[model samples]
Target: MSKQGHKTRANLPAGGFLAIGRDVTSTSDTSRSKPQVHKRELPQLSSGVLKKPRLDFSGKIPSSTPSTSSVKRAEVDDSRWRSFCAEIQIEPKQLLASLESAKEKQKPQKAARLICAAVREIIDHRKEIGSWVEEPIMCSALMLFVKMNTSFLLPHEELIEVLCSLLSTNFPTSSPGSAMAPLLLYKLLMRATDWNWRLVESFIDDSLHERQWTDRPSVDGLIVNIITAFGTRIPHESMYTACDLTYPERYRTVAEINRFTKVTDKEQKIDAFVMQMRDICERKGESAPRNLLRTMCTCAGNGNVRLLAARKMDSWLLNGKLQRYAMELLLWIASNIGQGELTEEDSETLSSLLKLRALKSKQINILFNIALKEILNNDKGMISAVAKLLLSNEFSANRFPYNMTMIHSLFSFDNRSASKVIAREIAQMLAAKEEYLRISRTFFREFVRSLLRMDFDFALFTSHLFNAATEDFSVLTIPTFFFKSLIDFCVMLPFLAITPTIREASQQRRSANGNLTQTHIDALQKFYADLRNFFEICTCFFRKHCELCTDNRLFVYSYYRVLYLAPAEYYTGIDQWPVETDVMQYMRVISDVPISEQLLCTVLEAGSDASVPIDAADTVDVIENLTKRASLSSTLTGSSMVPISTSTVLETIFRITEYKPPPTFNVQDENLPPLAVKTLYWKAWLISLIWTSLNTDTLVKEVYYNYPNLKLIMQIVLTW
Candidate 1:
């Protein structure tokens, strides 16, 4: 044999001399140090032909002569494999055979470790054989394992760790089977015994904070699926567990989660779960968990979910538990959802929220602002519904302050629609005079003030009021102050040009030609119609309760102010010339008092020039005429009327009064009629009669009791 061949032969195993496929040649000693041989290559025959080596049936084959199959078997028993089997206390082949068998029969206890091992292996080799997770065998085996070992798996934190790792690592790509990891996890959780929510929560926390699953939608979908699967199985005792499990502290709110991923359906399920828990709590007479309430609040962005959540919250609010949370959820729905989509239940929920007087002012403001926007933008009956609620008897005095602001905001958002609905409700309330009187005074004032703020067609409202009062005279029996508020609202309409402000704005809008435009003519014509309707309403009211018109000095003053301040153009070309004269005639007819010409002259003179000092004899004559008309005295004797100056008469009359003459009713405004001056002085004369005839204590009591009316009158005067 050649020296190189000898050296190769010398290096061969003791059991056999291996053959080389390549030629052996003389080479450097360093290159011949180790012989490189392909494991599969067999020793050659003596004729130098290749053939498989015969197995040695003799004592035992040399360990160094192990076949390629044995070497591969050794590689299978690597450190990872040994550790996996050791941890489960199962042999490698036994675990595999058990898993294979478990796929069919699902033997209890025997295959639990096998199933876990299979999953661990699948995850360990995720990058290479991730597709294996999608196989039917693997999926079936996993489901069976969970079914058979539910008790064991429930507390098995190690298995949970492995599954969560799989979820975190198996981020789905465009690859065909990349999503199977989450699917398998979902199926496992769904079929498993009730999960240890603590473990589940930890998983979610890790997935969100550590894995940043929210950064990847597919991964987020995986987490959402897992949560949905486990969330439904949450025990009622731990119902709030789903909240933290589904939406961890890292993702605080569903809204914040939405910023990163879309788990809308999952959030809906969580809401339903929490709501079910709330119902359970209610039945047991236990307070609902506030964490669950907070969970529902965070998830209120979903429409259907929010509706249900709103109702749940409303119940809590009514029961006076977690009212803050209930209010929060309701306001969220109101602001986020359109008013049109708001169900009647939602409206009631918001109404109930407003009814919660214990809520902070800021929360009330938020609730009302949302409701106002909803009423305006929503074509649903929310406008009418909320309007009725605001005007309802249940909206008590404690809530009145908030209700008033919300009512005004409603009108501000949509003047036309809001006012129409509100007016209709007010009219209906008027029909039930007793019930209407029961309404909050603040609400009634706000109703009137709201009407005045918007471009409401007062003609319609006044006509309704007139018809209602005519049908039932008791409808006109509201407080004199409220009646005045109504009158002030109707009489001060923008198109009527009755209030000083409207007349001033109208005068400023007149053309250079000093002629009204066609638009102005139409408005003026409509104003005449509305003014007539309003006068009809006033006539109906005064006819039934003429005492209210005559006895209430403030009422009488505003009534005469509205009647006399009416633009002259409306009553022009008619024989019943000044409407104030006609109103005075009606008053005299109703009360059997004679109309005094001296009083009319005094008003006309005051209207002609308010700055001019009245002659004392004229004032004394006016006072004597008023006193005789009032029947306080048939005539003022000279001794009784001795030395009474104009200042004394004026001070006695105007001292208790604080009303300012309207700026627009001055000589500068062309719209004011020559007889319009009677509004201030006639008001003064009638006020003096009512004041002098009535007890001073009574007058003082009326003035003091109706301070709100005084404030309202001041607002009107300033606005004018």
Candidate 2:
């Protein structure tokens, strides 16, 4: 027969097995001495019968030493190899028969050679064969064969060149075949722990730059693919210390990645990387691991892949253009760090990042407004998510940098309409369920601070809100520190003392009676006016919450703590409290709640011995240790439902009215503020004012009998 005709006949599909050209020159490094690969001539198919390769456990692989691509006899699994060949469409039984026949002849290398030829054939003709090469079966076959019989692997250097060549030279980068061809090579090389990975080292060393792969992107992606694939099989991939893989060295890249990464406009590169990540997240689900975020933070520990974008956030001029990109990137990363639900630690990291980059007050407002808008514009699901994040403990407290500025942003935004909604929603949310208070405590306290900063009109609005209350607002849910902070800001210290900025602004007119401009006086008057309704609303809320003692003991304890917050006091011309009776009525209502070491101290320390309310009554000798603890941390167990009745308060009040302190000033003896003394001073000033106002219908003059004997001390100790 003619040569071409013979080749055509030889190419025909076999009945059971198609005879293939076989070549094997260098299987192991020792075999490299005779490195020439000579192809065997093919004639026709044979219906070869089945037989298994002999097991050889004597050539056992040391578990301590990871195996190289150069396979050992004992590493060979006879059944797995057969299964692998079958997956690659080799007809396992026939391939086994051929292998067994070769072994009989002491030439098992021939079957290895045939399998390699078949793999190469599929790879080379992947396009002509369509998606067949993309099949999972094909991938599994290639991985299994290379992993099980690595001793039969194509020469390491040659295989690297061949795989790159097939993808870049023979196929288009966009082709599925081009993308997936390296998967098998990647498996083989990665499994071969002894491999020097000269291809990778050469790229990093730039040895291949002179003849660099033209379809550079394809090669770059394949390299990244290889690196990630290696991650999958690692024992503890997230912990590099546990694995031997040198990630940085492995990640060292050539043309495509380095090309774009080397671009001059660092912003452009960062934007590109971020957009790429965004696309990835959109393709995958939101909850998928944020690889890019991990990469930016973790990999950048060594400063990789345009990591300077985050570090240089402050240097970028907000020329209005570049900041948007950086902002978008930051927001994207923040949102995805935990799929629109960052954990506490992630929230802290984000807070630090923003704080570090927040160069100006305006920038804080901008982000604050954005966070607020997310809550305002989106559905409840998004609101809850954004609320959790934007109001995370890191950003909601007095300590966070720019937290006041954040509040100010809301104060000044779109006439503070959004801020109003936020405050109302928070109040209603907390009041409706006790759990909301625990989770959203800092936010509520900060919102209350912001409310204190608002004008008289806003305070009146909030006051009316509680008066016509509809929800289940519980003061017991309010954290003890929260109420204690309120006392410090409103009663013990000037309201402006809470924030440094406001304090500094008020330095010139620190006191209400100080020499001041009309504007300053007007501002002070408005602030104080805001306070009347503010404290009154707080009083009303506490009074109502006091009623909740029937609800629980925590409510019971928290109510009395709220009463002695700054000690009982009367007001003179403040609109809310006019007469001593009104003051007394307020006290009676709060004390009248049906519900401690803590109880005796407050009653004695706060009630007057012999004075009544006056413009400026003699300052009472201050009571000591009647100070409420920093928080109801230990004492207020809230373990029962019975309220502390008005009778208990009345008994304690009469008993302590006669008590006296050592008549010496050891005032400098303690470093902590004299909160109890100051509280008594204010109480004395208000006690005479606590007489029955006789105006209300529900409260009768007879309630005065609740503590008539206590008014004797009310005559002497008026609150300043």
Best by lDDT: 1
Each candidate structure's TM-score, on Cα atoms with residue i matched to residue i, is 0.35, 0.31
Candidate 1 Cα errors over 4 Å, as ranges: 1-294, 298-332, 335-348, 356-368, 375-379, 393-399, 434-456, 463-500, 503-720
Models, CA RMSD each: 23.7, 22.9
lDDT of 1 by residue, 1-720 (tens): 488778756554343564454575646673454344322232433313311232221111222211222111101112443344456543433454565565567444345456566665555554554445344455455655555555444434345445545444433343222334444444445444444332233333332222323334434433443343322111121222322223233233111111123333555544444455345445533255444454444334445445555545545665555666555545445544543466655565556545545434464455546544643454656666677777673354444555666666776776666656666665455444434433423344445555454355666656654444344444355443445444544443322323333343245343244554565545444554455455445544553444433244454344354444333443332223236554443333212222232333333344233343333233333444444434432111111211121223434444323233466656443554344233444565554434333333334345434444444554554589
- How many pairs of residues collide in each model? 1, 37
**lDDT tens digits, residues 1-720, model 2?**
368546645554442222333564435763533212211222212222111111121112222211121221111112333333443445433554544554567553454554544545555465354435333454445445555555555444445544444333233334444445455455555434333232332232111111123224434444543322111111112222222223333334521122122224444433444454344334433232222333332212122222333434443324343444344334323323332343454444444444543546465345435534432332323333333334443434544554444544444543345344444454544444444544444444455555544332445445434442334344445444433222222221122212333233244443456554665545544543454345445444544333433333343233233333334442222222225653443333222121232333333432342221110111122112222121111112232212132344333433343324444744453543423344444453233223222112322233444445444344344442
User: Against the unseen true structure, what C-alpha lDDT does each candidate score?
Assistant: 0.44, 0.37
lDDT of 1 at 23: 73
Error (Å) of candidate 1 at residue 206 is 13
Q: Estimate the lDDT of model 1.
A: 0.44
Total clashes for model 2: 37
